[model samples]
Target: MIEIKNLSHSFYVGKKGKEREIPVLNGISLEISQGEIASIFGKSGSGKSTLLNLISGFMKPGSGRILINGEDVTSFSEKQWAAFRLQNFGFIFQNFQLIPSLSTFDNVALPLVLEGVHASQRKLRVQEILQRVGLLEQANHFPNELSGGQQQRVSIARALILNPQIILADEPTGSLDSETEKEILNLIRELNRQQGITFFIITHDEEVAEISDKRFYLHDGALVNGGVSIEV
Candidate 1:
């Protein structure tokens, strides 16, 4: 339930008065249906991550419109974006993004805490998600105490704790071993199949793109595969 139209973005480098524009995304347009698993494949500096950031409201596009569930979020203020993101989006990062000091349970419970949920309810929600991600036993452990795969599961649990409509994953399996990556990928597929949560993944790995219902190749700040391709 996301639509992007004529999306473009650029960054300026060099000194203030004599800056040069570096285009990152150019006229990008795409639609992701509800419950769809979509992946964007691109090498470094191809604007795949930029597209995700724009859609996630982390930054505004230079010239474009972004619609999520029929509402134009292109001009949302920081406050509005924060509220909307908490209500609508989940995020998983390559680095897992877990706090070393917080245990798995607390890490996964942070979102609910931010939303002001009561302790009892937060406990139940966090436990359920942690179990779903197969990390219940590791709940008491800190991020540094767990393996890489376990830490990523903690990240996934944190993302799922709020029951977000869409999960935006960036290089989700990047730091894991091959076997762990396969396990994580299968978990993602199962989550999509069973929960109907939409997934928008940005990855360079073909194996990661293989799990998506639709895959697109992005190059030189433009989508090179017509913005939609089933083939890997």
Candidate 2:
């Protein structure tokens, strides 16, 4: 569903009024297919999130091409990029980044709200996704009213409520207890098949790689060729 070629990104640091180049992504390239669950694994400062941000068009690479569903997104204008992301991508973060003041239902409905979806239709979609995430009962609660795991479920509900073509999660299970982590992972697996949304996650968990169709191990901004292990 996505293709990246010759991607490289670097940040310039200003020290004593002098500029220094700090490279994060160095000539990396990779592809992900539709309906496949894949991962990018690496240590801290490995450029994994940089690659994800680049793909999301939130950040651009100094040099590279990013193709989503065969369209060149590298040069899309800001408005175009925003619309594209709303229609094509769902994002989940390590911290369950829900709006504390909004009810779970409202948080889940924010994406559609911004898109001008009517209240009735938005209710149906948000409720359905909340149910899928096992958070139907918690929908009326604010972010602080739920447990860590429950909050993450609401975040997942918010992300999936858009029914986007791709889901990008970064350290999804990092903050959960092992048992809760397993619960969240299983939800992701089930959602993958039932929704047919492409999954591209950056994780540090071994079991996550074991469950993926393909896995990429990144180091020092370069993709380790054939680095991601295939599902056995």
Top model number, TM-score: 1
Please give the lDDT score at residue 14 for candidate 1. Answer: 100
Where does model 2 exceed 4 Å of error?
A: 15-17, 226-232
Error of 2 at 5 (Å): 0.7
For model 1, residues 1-232, the per-residue Cα lDDT tens digits are 9898989999999999999999999999888899989999989889988999999999999999999999999999999999999999999999999988899999999999999999999998888998899989988999999999999999999999889999999999999999999999999999999999999999999999999988888999998865766643
> Clash pairs of candidate 2?
215-228
Error of 2 at 86 (Å): 0.2
Deviation (Å) of 174 in candidate 2: 1.1
lDDT (CA) per prediction: 0.93, 0.87
TM-score of 1: 0.97
Q: How much does each candidate deviate from the true structure in C-alpha RMSD? A: 1.1, 1.6
- How far does residue 16 in candidate 2 sit from its true spot (Å)? 9.7
